[model samples]
Target: MAKDHTDPIKDLRHNTAQPFEAARAMPPSVYMSDSFLNEELTHIFSKDWFCVGRADSLAEPGDYTTCELAGQPIIVIRDRDGALRAMSNVCLHRMSTLLHGRGKTRAIVCPYHAWTYNLDGSLRGAPGMTRNTGFCKDAYHLPEIRCEEWLGWVFICLNEDTPPVAEQLADVEDLVAGYDMTNYTETFFEEHVWDTNWKVLAENFMESYHLPVCHAGTIGGLSKLEDMVCPPGLPAFNYHTILKDDQLRIAMAHPSNDRLKGDERRTTFLLAIYPSLMITLTPGYFWYLSLHPKGPGQVHIRFGGGMSDDYAGDEDAQSNFEALKTLLDDVNVEDRGCTEKVYRGLCSDHAVPGHLSHLERPNYDFAQYLMARLEEGRAD
Candidate 1:
């Protein structure tokens, strides 16, 4: 057992660094407005880089994968030279999907017109069309999206104009550099369609206020109720750090002593990349979450997990990690259930924007930033 000390001032300061202001309340309309969601897809999702899948999905040359981002279908593949590329899944001829599913395809073939594209998204063959007669094979190739692989993730941006991931996330590089994600491998992947708006899930993920109450049984003990804080000034797109009770370190195999016993063996450190992606890094494991906006109040969430390769062939370790994932899923189910109901409440006449607690600075700041961007979009 570890030593326990009750320091109210330290705990209060940790959670109450930000001052509360009632005017900062985020109206429910932001969550339930069909129009607002569309704006988000255009202004937010299109303007930012999103982590769509893991690099391992296309680990080998010729391996291809597919996903949907901002309501547009996308295809990702590793070229013959092992470089990753992303392209719109739509065929240029008939707009039909080019690739059906993931596979090691020599060349992606469209079922509609049999148009074939190389793994690099170059037009290889258009079955019946001649290369002459002003029909340029190069001009008919698939439209490419700016995609990059970093720390084992495949990130794609619909906008060819967004800044590179490294540039956008320059400030948090030191924080991210602390992790060794190279050792992790997939441990779980799950997709859930929710009745709530994407922001509802975003808000739910932005703070730990609900953890002590909503997750009392599962993570209540693992997280410190008062110490949960996310320092402000983090970049708009990357909310990479979640400060929780240092005691959660016990959950990891590592042992520690002192006021920051678990910081070294953290059981909870989640990152939310704006628009739609959340990643959790913990000792011996981690997981990825991809969020898709189906409508203003409907969203789809995909969950995937990874572990260090050193633990790869070990069934015992794998089983333990899987159990942790199950626990996380159970907690997520609780979050989803309430969020859907919140979406309904947002549309109610009695709905009112709520104030932000000092500890919920990240949630408040994120909402404010999103609103400001949307307002800018409305202006433009």
Candidate 2:
């Protein structure tokens, strides 16, 4: 049976006034309905810049890995000369997916059609079609994707005509300028498949209103929830930020094993890039992120952490890093638990749009930005 839904945020107190007046009211269906999910995938996911993987993944020439960008199957590889390249994993002949996972592949081969492609996405060979009239070796190569690496992470845009990654993220460089990310190495990697819309997760990350309540045991006591500062709203290019207090910084920077003390301790600067990429950087540690939309009610989150290669060989540093990973795990558990419940309420008939506190204006801005992008695609 179709569920009856209502706004969960209506007739409630708002901590702030103006700007969000138009967004103060929206249906819960926006979070739980199948129709809404389909629209988001079509409009927002397909066209946006997406973080794919860490640059370290392709450390050598002929190194390739397969990943999906907003549901579009793509493969990234390091060519013979060590340049990184992104290409559609789909075969030209049968449209079958090409690469499967990470490895050193001399060339990408389609299992179904046996069409082969070079590391540069050029067609090398195709069995049984050497003289096919419709087939032109020059024009039958795999489709290439636009890709760029920023701060050690690989980002790809499926749309060939999309803006350059550096230009698109030009506005956010200052937001991340404070952290010394050069000290981090890839120490932790994780992914969570949550039963909720991607926007819900993104919005939750942007706001700290639930920290004191939802993360009481895990983070509430460890950080200042009330003083959390959110940068006005999401940017024109799909980015948002949440600034945590010194307490949160200390907890993350203090390595459990206590390898480096004194000046090593520093602040944690977090950045959320549009579509679905989250980067949490401290003076000595960092978390790389990639969010994939699985369905209206599901999202696949990819997270990776890296520390400086100098720290990579330090046994004490590696052990101490568990403290940061543990903290992140606790936060993730708390977040996923609450968001799952929110998903249930959004699908409930008793639900209504909830009010945003003045502190939650950042959350409001994120939602508005998302709605704008989603709406833009629907119009086009």
Candidate 3:
């Protein structure tokens, strides 16, 4: 349990229950305390189904990617049987990390002692353990982790009892049905270490309140506060809708699809899947961020997205993708500056919670989610 220096859990409980008009931001200690971060790693991230990357990226049977979640190294791979598998990346022989990064591998061989395992996590060979009596290689396979495929994305949970991703995200699937997201190809993917708390980035992506001020030169002109719609939070996710008076800049520059009609052509949806998945959907493009806490003040961000098949197959796709990537890069620069400064302010001795704006309803719901997870931890 986290030491109660500022009673943030109490504050979270109180403020999260208030009406939107009277709601308050979470306390700074929630973002600045190492103890609280450790608690979050155990109670929130580890126990939830967290997205890692697009399953489509591992199209081939032997493709794999390595990542760290809750300080535990993980390997997500597509086996020779075309099944997606997740397992502890630690070599069973000497506890060394088996894989360093993304690649195609026929077998996961521990460099330390040459102990080899098949892609399905079954032990294939042990270099010198044959001489030992009573040694059972069958019982020495790499430990498997809970993994699931939702839409076209890959999600893993450390806790075996966590609910299935499909069950939790059923409503979200309906909400985004028109987009045909499963067919969307990933044209861009990158990992970045940002100097901000994971929640800060999650909150930033969940609301459009900062668009006009923080993204003024880029996406700001396309937004109007009156047109924004903030929906109540769900048990598994929270979302807000942004109505554009005109087509998005990229949409205007490329061919539009007939599949989307009316407001779907001009509406944008920003959704935060509790704990760490943030997705933004527009008519022509979609992008997302999967956040992982590195410490109290650092977050590892997996950022990527791509155009819908309709637009991706367009003749102008190469040029439009370049333009869209440039625009997103600029927007990210603006966001990084603001979030880093906010983190610095959070460390101040005089830091305190402030009343939230109506546009920040998503942030309020996020507070609720955090409180619910903390309470669950206490119960356990």
Candidate 4:
């Protein structure tokens, strides 16, 4: 059913405007309202530094991946000179979208008309345009989009005015500098469309308060309520910290790593890079989800993870990693179930938000972030 609220935007403001001790879950209508989602699409998704994936994933020239920002199709590729680039994925000739998924493409060729483009996004050739008086192949090319690499991750910004990826995430860099996350190698990449609002999953990751109950079958046992620490978030991101024991292996620093000391070696940082990138970075490994809303009811997720370079070569580490992957997959199953259920409850007519726990500090900050972004958009 469509949301029948008078003003989701007002409700959003009123809900997040409260003090931390008075914070409650945001009104469900904001998650279900078309107008609110459109506000987010315009303000948040369009103007933020959106993380796509790791840079090393496209090491070779011609390697590319496709994504959607707001409603515009985008392509991120490595050009002949080995520089990372982004451009409109739609063909200039007839507006057909180029590239579908991750792959190595010699050039961007439109499936609809076979209009060929160079790796640099310039027009290469066209099927049949020799007779058109107005046709000038040299004058046509795909519009370039801004792309950048911070550490080893690739980020695409739709709004040219948005801050550079490095500056926006500078605090985050300082937080995980000891792990040297750029050296982390991506071991797997997968995409999933879950039946839930994107914020539901984002909030789920923003706090560890749910780990004990929602993830009981898997990672639940690893975390305790007393140890979770949620602090106030910065303008560009929010984060929390939890301690990991040495027994978790990948969650702890490798013996060769001399950079981390004491708790620093075992602490796992849950970073919510604003808009929609949630990263779980520990001393030895990291995983992340880059989310996009499919609609009021679903979210498209770019899921991937990897091991640190410190674990570069060890047969036993490989064995443990495979086991770890299995465990993580189980954890995802638990999260999907929990988040989907939350969305269902939000859609209910009688749904009312409950008070937030102190452990939900990041989530409260996220709501405030949304309001701030929306207000900024309104000002523009």
The top-ranked prediction according to TM-score is 4
Candidate 2 local Cα displacement, residue 377, angstroms:
3.0
Q: Write the per-residue lDDT of candidate 1 for residues 308-333, one digit (tens) a residue.
A: 55455655765666677778788887
lDDT of 4 by residue, 1-380 (tens): 44564588899899988999999999898888888889999999999988899998999999999999999999999999999999999999889899998999898899999999999999999978999999999999789989999989999988989989898889989988898989999988999999999999999999899999999998898988898889999999999999987768878899999999989988999999999999999888889999999888899999999899998786687877888889889999999999999999998889999999999999999999999999989999
Q: How well does candidate 1 score on lDDT at residue 23?
A: 32
| Residue 68, candidate 2: alpha-carbon lDDT | 80
The C-alpha TM-scores of every prediction are: 0.84, 0.82, 0.94, 0.98
Clashes of 3: 0
Model with the higher lDDT, candidate 3 or 4: 4
- By lDDT, the candidates rank as 4, 3, 1, 2
TM-score of 2: 0.82
lDDT of 3 by residue, 80-188 (tens): 9899999999998889999877889999999899889999998899977878898788988788999999989899999988889999999999998877678777888
RMSD of 4: 1.0
The CA lDDT at 296 in model 4 is: 85
Q: What TM-score should be assigned to candidate 1? A: 0.84
Global CA lDDT of candidate 3, please?
0.85
